[model samples]
Target: MLGGFGTLPGKLIWPTSVTTSPDGDLVVKDSGTGHIQIYSPDGDFKQRFPYGFEPIKGMGDVTCMRSGVILVTNGTRIIQLFSKDGELIHELKSPKLTWPYSYGITVMQSNKIAVSDWTDGGKINIIGVDWRMNAILKTNAIEGFHRPVRIAVSKNEDLLVTEGQLFGRFQGCCIKVIDKNRHLKRTIGPRYGKTFSFENPSGISVDSPGNIFVTDEDRNYIVMFNPDSSLSAVIVSEGLQGPSSLSVMEHGLLAVADCYNHCVKIFRYK
Candidate 1:
């Protein structure tokens, strides 16, 4: 039985990423508190993993695998693997990454890990890590990125990136899809201009049916699109204030991290 949207005792301070483990446990990255919080499927507190080698430091995104291993970024181009019991197992460092602020991470079905390195160079760095958390292959800096924030992998192993850059008083954001070989496949959303469409697209995830869902932070809604880049529908257009991250469950259930609202909203898809 599904218990409605569960609440956290303390407010989630600057929650960045939320994902489910292979056992259906909910894991959240609290950037403000610089730690990862785990919750059981029933919304009970499991445990908290501190950042750095110290306790309660700061961390970036968190991605979990089916085998119960958790991957977290330290915002310093370093990825740390933690055991199911919250013990640091392994750590991998990226020397090419000078600026910390690496925002997004996704683990493929094959257990390969991919992360987005956001820097001032205006390029997106795609780093592929092996099962041991060692950087095996990396793509050249893909230019034309203002602020690559989030990333998602499709069923076909394609990469989708969200670019969020503030322009003037407005935030210009868009999504770009890349092939497995790190080639630009297609660009979604409006072209770069004054009247651009997306406003700070922060989160992205693809459903099993090949549908893409993105959280438009400024618009306060979740936008869905077909695999071919066509708009499908707006899942939620209201009752959202600064939706940051999202995770799609198995049975058409959607979870949106409502940042300003300080809660994760669970919705059943019809």
Candidate 2:
């Protein structure tokens, strides 16, 4: 079993993504600071990678691949690959990605990448890249999205997406589930108002048990749901200012990038 809320030193500035390395180290993308910070499981500072350039204006979102490589989205419809220690390994660019503002990225088991391009008519693209970040196989957008923010793949291979409303401000954003064939499975939430009871839903991750965890930035809480879209529980409701990205560690432990507070908070399942 995992315990809740461990203490850590150092601050993160405008952190956008949080991911755990295979070695149990917590990695984060600090957008404001233009750097990546690594932390031990116990919240000890390990190292920092400056990223060498501004990622927010150039890259929309960044994440660590399952194979331990880092993928960063370039606003110009390209993906940059970097070593875990912040070394520039390679880059992936395609003309198909114009006006790209990729806000989410996830690595599939097939070693391909599913990235969200948030543009006029938003799209989710699956791109195949080699070890050198070279493009292999590429697929077009499966569906037109309103404003896709974050993404998560279920154990059953289902793709889950959270949509953010462009107009109006309230909790009612919707979570859209799609099958492997890119077919829409169902829509969840949109319960509170036009926002679907989710205010600024950003980061999402799934546990080994097939439970889904979503960070409601405006609500300052992490919402958990079962595979059936039923409410399971609220994991962390306090000590968070703006939770952006989520990554699950071993033993049901969760790492959250609290953007506003400029710190990563770890929560354990009780």
Candidate 3:
């Protein structure tokens, strides 16, 4: 466990997204407190970015680019970029993002930015490194996208998205896998029988080997998937509650934002 209630510096209230910096530091967003906490690779809290003057009310997923720039989705039409030292760089907005309430975000190996929007029928907007619109993915491209929340890009550029229900009863909880050519390849869970059904698939991440890791909030477990999208195992489920985000770190380390527990947990899955 990396953070919890204590006098320690790595305290978290409701950690939602966890990612790694270029230098191997862990960057976590505590949505409940609107604070972005930075921790060393060894799990020591280093610093936090406090947007106290302009609180981020709808903070979403956070990702770090190869250039060490951090991108954050704030549940609005725009995305925010910050320096490694937590200094705000600027906000990204475009007319192409008509009614965006951006959520899931990731930096592709090609340096493209993939962002999921929950408004106006749910879509994923791809932006270039120069911050220009590259493409937009929607149900027209695939049949299974309803409120896509989180996204992970595989080594081959395959996009794996988590479909989550924001409010009311849970309705369409599954992971939609789209190939590099924008074709729906597969849809996992929410229908994989009782054993593998996902109640609330929230966080998702891809390892160096192309294996997929997902966090089920309602089930309180982290499940692993093979490179071919086969179920490898339910790697975690003990003493967990409402795990939100997942990030595969270096040296076989996996970091999870245990939301209900108000902390981040690291595991050696390899």
Candidate 4:
């Protein structure tokens, strides 16, 4: 309840994404005002990155890396690297990206960054630490992605991306799992809810214990999928405007962006 309707320091207006710094500060990217606001552990506004920093005009997502540097998406075109103290360090973009925009990004311990392109059949590009665009990950249309969005990397080296939004008589949403070898492991979709299946699972994260946490945007709840492929629990099922994005901290705290509600909700998911 730290942020809600209002124009103040800690108040948030229609935030689209939430992530945590290495030391546990909450980093939120608001599309409403196009500002990246960092809050202290106790919810005090610590730093702010103003709008217009991106030549493209808005910030998309914020991912705080282990080195304390923050990687921010331009909403389209490129991802910019910024220092924890709020200085723009560098930018990560590839001349080979045909789509030009990235809505999702994840930094690996191996110094590689995974960027997602939701357009044109769905592609995830891997970039080296030196900032060279490596490879557009090899994925079969059937085995891996149909329409990909947010992506997460697990401790066991599995890359999970939200895949769905297919048209036709066959309609459903699922999480596509890829291993270290870049081979498709399996696709896990919504199956256990009593009233509805997972509708518009936009954001996903894999916990240390191999459990998966996903945000069902249309349903306004967060679903926990166990490693055994079973539904564990559903969080904030009521009063959520649009639970679209989620981030799991190193210490296991879950940060969810309640899109339409104009706030971010933090949870202790065990």
- lDDT, each prediction: 0.70, 0.72, 0.80, 0.71
Poorest lDDT segment (10 consecutive residues) of candidate 1: 1-10
Cα lDDT tens digits for candidate 4, 18-64: 88788888888877777778887666778778544444432256787
lDDT of 2: 0.72
Ranking by lDDT: 3, 2, 4, 1
What tens-digit string does per-residue lDDT give for candidate 3 at 1-270? Answer: 878854235687778889999999999987766777899999988998863311344447899999898888868777778889999887776565553577889888878778887666577776664534323332222334688888999989999999876664576688999888878889887856356788889899998888999999888989998988888889997878888899999999999998878899999999
| lDDT for position 262 in model 1 | 57
**lDDT score for residue 23 of model 2:** 79
**Per-residue lDDT of model 2, residues 134-211, tens digit only:** 665656576577778777888777888877655554423778888888899987776632333776677888877888
List the lowest-lDDT window of 10 residues for candidate 4: 134-143
RMSD of each: 4.3, 4.2, 3.4, 3.8
| Decoy 2 TM-score against native | 0.87
Q: Among all windows of ten consecutive residues in candidate 3, which has the lowest summed lDDT?
A: 133-142
Error of 1 at 60 (Å): 3.0
Question: TM-score of model 1 relative to the true fold?
Answer: 0.83
> Largest TM-score belongs to which candidate?
3
The better candidate by lDDT, 1 or 3, is 3
Global fold similarity of model 3 (TM-score): 0.89
Error of 4 at 94 (Å): 4.0
Clash list (residue pairs), candidate 4: 77-100, 77-101
